[model samples]
Target: MDTTALAHAFTQACTREGFTELVEVEREAHGLWDTHTHPFEAKALILAGEIRIRTEDGTDRTYRAGEVFHLQHEEPHAEWYGPEGVRYLVARRSRAG
Candidate 1:
């Protein structure tokens, strides 16, 4: 689909889904969840509040609502709620060899 068409499709999909929809989920509070390297890279968008992320390189960042960020495959990292708390949508895809 063209960009416009693809966007329309996504809009429809988002609107059709309920807020409390159940998707694959894993909750980890400081090493509680598995942190194995992902087979692919990924990205996440902050839908509400703020989020704090720490990378293996010792780098850290915070993302607020409407903000988007990326994660490279094999890059170790951890994510948590910022002072105001946060919720985000995480999108991932396996890397192509």
Candidate 2:
């Protein structure tokens, strides 16, 4: 993966272990990652700023520092940050069951 492109999207620390990867992202403007699902478990932790994750159910949930979210691969979701952007970390682990 192009670390620079990923960085351009949002400044973050990305690391991979086997099929799992974790990324710490900080955005300065409204940012969005298209909706999709993988065969793994995904989690995002709000470190400083705020963001919202839109689930397939149309439920929108906001998270801030000290908050964490967990989603399974079967659960498709889209993500977006607030007007001021967001600072958070996302981690993914395989669930290709």
Candidate 3:
């Protein structure tokens, strides 16, 4: 789907899934992030370039444009941006007690 249509559908899905916030993020080319955790769960749709994420279990996966990935709240993981950098739309949902 085109970018506009993809974004709309993604937004709707996020809302239906109880995501409270949505944001667009861009990472610099070849950038790497050390293992980290988030307070909220995240679901993202890649819009440009690529990103590879590695979890504590050593499971690594690359997500390219038009692809989606999800991380649960406080799930430790590291990120690497592809040569051309990456851009994606992410939806976040706060963890319930």
Candidate 4:
């Protein structure tokens, strides 16, 4: 699907799934982030370039334009951006008590 359609569909899905926040994110080329965790669950759709994420299990996976990745609340992970950098739309839902 095209970017517009993809974004629309993603938004609808996120809303249905109880995501309360949506945002666009961009990363610099060849950048890296040390392992971290988020208090909220996240779902993202890659829009440009590519990204590699290393999960707590040490498994690394690359996500390129048009792909999607998800992380559960407090799930430890690290990120690496591709040479051309990356952009994505992300939806986040807070963890319930």
Residue 9, candidate 2: Cα error in Å is 27
Q: Arrange candidates, best lDDT first.
A: 3, 4, 2, 1
Per-residue C-alpha lDDT of model 4 across residues 1-97, encoded as one tens digit per residue: 5988998999999999999899999999999999999999999999999999999998899999889999999999999999999999999999998
- Per-residue accuracy of model 2 over 26-85 as CA lDDT, tens digit each: 987688887987677766666677788889989999887667677877788988888878
Estimate every model's Cα lDDT from 0 to 1.
0.55, 0.70, 0.96, 0.95
Native-to-model Cα distance after best TM-score fit, residue 65 in candidate 3, in Å: 0.3
Candidate 4 local Cα displacement, residue 83, angstroms? 0.6
RMSD of 4: 0.8
Report the alpha-carbon TM-score of model 1 versus the true structure. 0.57
Query: RMSD in angstroms, candidate 2?
Result: 7.8
What is candidate 4's CA lDDT for residue 6? 91
TM-score of each: 0.57, 0.64, 0.97, 0.96
lDDT of 1 by residue, 4-93 (tens): 454344335444532222122233333222244665565655655666777888888877666666778777877776455555565565
Global lDDT of model 1: 0.55
Q: Which ten residues in a row have the lowest lDDT in candidate 4?
A: 1-10
Decoy 4 TM-score against native: 0.96
Q: In candidate 3, what are the lDDT values of residues 30-91, reduced to their tens digit?
A: 99999999999999999999999999989999999999999999999999999999999999
On the 0 to 100 scale, the lDDT of residue 54 in model 4 is 98
